[model samples]
Target: MVTSNDLLIKQRSVIKFLAAEGCSAANIHAKMKTVYGEMCISDCAVRKWVRIFKGEDPREIILRDRKRSGSPLSALVTAHQEKVDCMIRANRRVKQKEIANAVGISKERVHHIITTVLGYLKVSARWVPRQLTVEMKAQRKDMCTQLLELSTVCPRMY
Candidate 1:
């Protein structure tokens, strides 16, 4: 699938090429409108790019979008996941907000890591593995079998 960023780059490249050929911004926008239709960028945006391409040094014409200065969109790196897992294992009843503060992430991300990534669930105010281990399964089966035998031996106590 062609992403919006890719489409923007395509349009920027076209703008640069047309500007190099001395085509006015109005003419370039008109041509792009016919080709891109509803997907076409605004005339103001076309004019901005045209001015950038025409005014800037020829060697500095960047077709790709520049990186912006801000916090990243996600902090779901493996280090953060590992830290969250360790914190949970160390204290199953630890709060998500505490984990987020310690791990330098958001509470929602910590919850996501615990429930989705680590396969844990909140049970009785504590974090527990969603799936039982083999030993736990066997222990439960043995207890059930013992109860069944006792109920059969003492039918009146059922």
Candidate 2:
């Protein structure tokens, strides 16, 4: 089935053609229901388009969709990011819903926190480990170097 967007595009094209043919708004709206079936463009929309075509140069009018402010990002889970991280660290197998329920936030917000701020993704339905901080990397390097020095000093241990 054609989506609402696709139907709008189709209706706009029809409106352009009807306008070029010098058809009235009422005429266009009347034909719309029969031509487009249940997805017919509303008469109010037809009237609006009629006004647009009448007052403005149709050729220069941009057919692009108007910009819209989409749904706002809810970051209620952000304060809980560290807590969630700790929980996951304690048990990587814990479910997102469980965490959300435990923390009292939407699972989607929890998901955003886990994947974005924490930089984690499910590996086999389990979150991938967060990236190590610079200090952690440095400490690990020093530990490996000390282990190498010890191995050299006591060769038999290798």
Candidate 3:
């Protein structure tokens, strides 16, 4: 599959070739739109690349995107997930904010890990697994049976 980066490089190559042939940015952009259709780069981007190719030395032209500076968008590594799971197991009533602080991730990430990754749901202010074990299911059945027996033995006072 052609990834976005590959598509970008392809567009840059075309832009460089056309620029070298002295084609105007407007003409290059029009041709690119016809070939790439909806996936074509913006006209402004085409113009910018054309300018760079025309002004810079051929050897100095960069076809790849530059490195960006900022904190990563996600902290969903296995280590962080394991830490959050351990924290939740240790304290069923743990809050997302507390987990975020302890795990050094955002509260939203902690919530996503708990609900989506770990398959947990909040019940009575505690995090519980979404699926119950066979033993747990049997225990719940027994409890319900006992409650029914008691209800039959002692009818409602009203």
Best lDDT among the predictions, by candidate number:
3
TM-score of each: 0.67, 0.44, 0.65
For model 3, the run of ten residues with the poorest summed lDDT: 56-65
lDDT of 3 at 68: 98
lDDT for each of the candidates? Answer: 0.89, 0.81, 0.90
1-158: candidate 1 lDDT, tens digit per residue: 98999999999999999999999989999999999899899999898889889985454668986789987644458898889889888999999999989988888888888888889999998999999989999999999999999999998998
**Whose TM-score is greatest here?**
1
lDDT per residue as tens, model 2, 32-111: 98888778878988887876766663544434587789655655435588788888988988999999998777898888
Write the candidate numbers in order of decreasing lDDT.
Answer: 3, 1, 2
How many angstroms is residue 114 displaced in model 3 relative to the true structure, after the best TM-score fit?
Answer: 1.4
Clashes of each: 0, 0, 0
Where in model 2 is the C-alpha error above 4 Å?
56-60, 68-158
Which residue pairs collide in model 3, if any? none
Q: What is candidate 3's lDDT per residue for 1-158, written digit by digit as tens?
A: 99999999999999999999999999999999999999999999998898789885454579987889977655558898899989999999999999999888999988889999998999999999999979999999999998888888887931
Against the true structure, candidate 2 has what lDDT?
0.81
* Better lDDT candidate (1, 3): 3
